[model samples]
Target: MPARVFVALMVTDSGALTAAELAQTLRVSPAAVSGAVRYLTRLHLVIREREPGSRRDIFRVRDEAWQDALANRDALLAQYSGSFAEGVSVVGRETPAGRRLTEAMEFFEFLRKELDGLMDRWRAHRDAPRPDGPPA
Candidate 1:
């Protein structure tokens, strides 16, 4: 697990590193690092590359990886929204069941709005310039 932590930190910085280098930095055996790398790779979170002059494999986190992951999450919410819409229709607008479904739909609708707001804030933050001096 320490190796995985090291791998995460390593990739977070420059997005690429070799297994041997990771092992040395983490003070673990090459086998251990290799195992962790293999696991991360299998999860599709990491990709492997080979240098032209070396046999060591470099592991990297795919560009826009989190974007794809979040898209998958939003897709699920959209699917649920469709199902909840059906619930609202089936229960009819005047009944208690209909009211409950409407509430559920409203809740998810609010969630979707909040997610949009969050993404807006995230983009704003990402585009904002960093401070030049030390923090207070």
Candidate 2:
């Protein structure tokens, strides 16, 4: 349901919707929309805000939602790397299981570092001058 709502917001011409609007557009009940929005907001996928000059809340797909989501995983990657490294020590480095854990830890650490480089490359690509010139 959250994925549905995210996609709906992405494809909307207005780029924002009220819960009632989402409910109507997706043919779902208000309760379902409520639950989906709650989950999405926690993940920073959709931002909740008030309509101009009104008290009603509006939901919109965040401009950097994908980049933000990917970037947010750094801590999680570090957590996994730490946990796996601990497991290697617990099992003794000479054992097969310890070797496996070491490999896994290294993989996650590599991902954490590569993710930083990947984001940098993405920023460079995004900011690079266009050969055809700026949009009209």
Compare the candidates by TM-score and give the number of the best one: 2
lDDT of each: 0.70, 0.92
Q: Mark the 10 consecutive residues where model 1 has the least summed lDDT.
A: 1-10
Off by over 4 Å in 2: none
- Model 1 ranges with Cα > 4 A deviation: 1-59, 133-136
Using alpha carbons, what is the TM-score of model 2? 0.91
lDDT of 1 by residue, 20-80 (tens): 7777777788888778877766555667899669886787776655554454466567777
**Per-residue alpha-carbon lDDT of candidate 2 for residues 28-124, written as tens digits (9 for 90 to 100):** 9999999999999888889999999999999999988888889989989999999998999899877999999999999999999999999999888
Q: How far is candidate 2 from the true structure (C-alpha RMSD, Å)?
A: 1.6
Which candidate tops lDDT? Answer: 2
**TM-scores of all predicted structures:** 0.55, 0.91
Name the lDDT value of residue 49 in candidate 2.
96
